[model samples]
Target: MIIRKATHTDIPSLVILMNNFRKFYQQESNTEEVKSFLKERMDKGNSVIFVAILEDKLVGYTQLFPSFSTIKLEKIWILNDLFISEKFRGLGVASQLLTRVLKFSQETHRHQVWLLTGNDNKSAQHLYRKIGFTNTKFKHYVYNF
Candidate 1:
């Protein structure tokens, strides 16, 4: 297995994985929209994505969007998406992807990395805790437009 930063050439695979992730969250899948969204992020250089490969096949990915903490005055990464194909689950793919994200954060001198997953996503929660993430005192609230 190999894990590496995603480049423009990997957009097609990224789109597929992203759609799968959306579907997992019960969102309607729109390939074109997903492609456009990811393309914009890649073009603007506002996000970092890592892909996992096995036997030359793309198996999984995680995406991080850069942000900053006003109080801390430091860079942070919002881990917005993580997905592994059903066939590729249980193979440590998500764990490897997260490890790479943390390594990148440290190397870039980022102050922190954070993520949110579905409340019912027990599997993901387990993996996150196993990898050293913890629940925080703060609650995450969002107002969608």
Candidate 2:
């Protein structure tokens, strides 16, 4: 398996994986919208995406968006998305992708990386804890428009 940053050439395969990810979260599937959203992010360089390829096939991916931490007075990363194909699960693909993200964050001198997962996602929570991420005391809240 190989882990690397995603390029424009990767958008097609990425769309499939991203759609699957959304489906897992009970979101509606819209390939056209997914394509457009990914294209915009890639074209604008607004986010960092990494892909995992196994035997020449895209098997997994993770995406991170840049943000600032006012308390730390430094840049931080929101690890927004991570998904491994069902067949590729438990093969350490997710770990490899996350390792790459953390390495990139360190290289860029970011203050920290933050991510949230549903309480029911035990597998993901386990992997994240194994990777040295700790549960925070603060609660997260969002107001939908």
Candidate 3:
């Protein structure tokens, strides 16, 4: 298994995996649409993505958006997306991707990183805990209009 930050050439596979991730959240998104969105983001330096591969096949990925925290007076990384393909769920793909994210944060000297997952997703919660994200009592209050 190999894990690394994604590049423009990896966009196609990344998009497909992102579409699957959306479907898991009940969103009906197309791969082409995802690809286009990702392409624009890449060109604009809007976000970061890390992909996990096995035997030359893309298996999973995690994406983070660079944001700022006034309180910390530093950059904040919103761990926006994480998806391990169905075929790779039992493997260590998600763990590896998250490790990469944390390492990236440390290397970049970012303020901090955070992610939100549904309360019922016990498996994901377990993974997050196993990865050492504990005691993060941060609450999400979103008002989308």
Candidate 4:
């Protein structure tokens, strides 16, 4: 398996993985929209995406968006998406992807990498904790438009 940053050439394979990820979250599947969104992000260079390839096949990916922390007065990263193909699960692919993200954050001197998972996602929670991420006391809230 190989882990590396995503490039323009990756968008096609990424779209499939992204669609599957959305489906896992109960989101509607829209390949064109996913492609457009990813293209925009790539064109703008506003986000960082990493992909895992195993035997020449894209197996997993994780995306991080840039943000800033007022208290830290420095940049931070929101680890927005992480998905491994169903067949690739339990193979340490997710952990490898996350390790890459943390390495990236360190290399870029970011304050931290933040991520949120559904409360019901116990498996993800377990993996995160096992990888050294601690549960925070802070509450996360969002207001949908």
Candidate 5:
């Protein structure tokens, strides 16, 4: 498997995975906004995307958004999205994509990386733990209004 940063040319595959990610969350939206949305982020260097390719096919991806941490007084990243195609689930693709981000954070001296998943996603929780991520004492709540 090959792991690398995403380019504009990779948008189609990225959009596909992102749409799947949303579906996994029980959202019904399509990839309608992905192309232009990702283009803007990529063009401005506001986010980072990494993909896992096996035999020239994309099977997984991780998207991270950069933000500052007032508490830590430094820049941090929110690994806002991660997805591995259903067909590639057990192939360690998720681990590979996450490891790339972990390495990238360390190399760049970032303060931290954060991500959240559904409470019922036991498998992903296990994977997160295996990757050195721990459960926080605080709860996450979102209001979509």
Candidate 6:
């Protein structure tokens, strides 16, 4: 298994996984929109995406968005998306992707890495805790436009 940063050529595979991820979250899947979104981010260098490849097949991916912590006066990474293909679920692909994220964060001197998951996603929660992420006490608030 190889985990590495994504390039433009990886978009098709990414779109497939991203669509599946959206469906997993009960959201509508739009391949063109997802591909365009990822392309824009990659073109603008606005986010970091790591993909897991096994024998030339893209099986998993995790995306991080750059942000800052005013309180800490430092940069942080918001791990906004993570997904492993259904057939590759039990093979530690997600863990490998996460490990790459953490290593990237540290190498880039970021203050921290954080992510949000559905409250009902016990499996994800378990994987996160196992990977050394702690649950934050703060509540999340969002206002959709």
Which segments of candidate 4 are over 4 A away from where they belong? none
Against the true structure, whose TM-score is highest? 2
Candidate 2 segments whose C-alpha is farther than 4 A from its true place? none
TM-score of each: 0.97, 0.98, 0.92, 0.97, 0.94, 0.97
Each model's lDDT: 0.95, 0.96, 0.88, 0.95, 0.89, 0.95
Candidate 2 collision pairs: none
lDDT of 2 by residue, 109-139 (tens): 9979999998899999999999999998889
**Deviating ranges (above 4 Å) for candidate 3:** none
lDDT of 5 by residue, 66-117 (tens): 8888878998889999899998899899998898999999888897999998
- Per residue, candidate 3 scores C-alpha lDDT tens digits across 5-53 of 8899998788889999999888898888898899998899889888899
- For every candidate, C-alpha RMSD to the true structure in Å: 0.9, 0.7, 1.4, 0.8, 1.2, 0.8
Pairs that clash in candidate 3: none
Worst 10 residues of 5 by lDDT: 29-38
**Which of 4 and 5 is the better model by TM-score?**
4
lDDT by residue (tens digit), candidate 1, 1-145:
9999999999999999999999999999999999999999999999999999997989999999999999789999999999999998999999999999999999999988989999999999999999999999889999999
Once all C-alphas are superposed, what RMSD does model 3 give against the true structure?
A: 1.4
Write candidate 6's Cα lDDT for 26-66 as tens digits: 99989999999999999999999999999689999999999
> Model 2 — which ten-residue stretch has the worst lDDT?
110-119
Q: lDDT for model 1, on a 0 to 1 scale?
A: 0.95
Better of 1 and 2 by TM-score: 2
Tell me the number of clashing residue pairs for each predicted model: 0, 0, 0, 0, 0, 0
Two-way lDDT contest, 4 vs 5, winner: 4
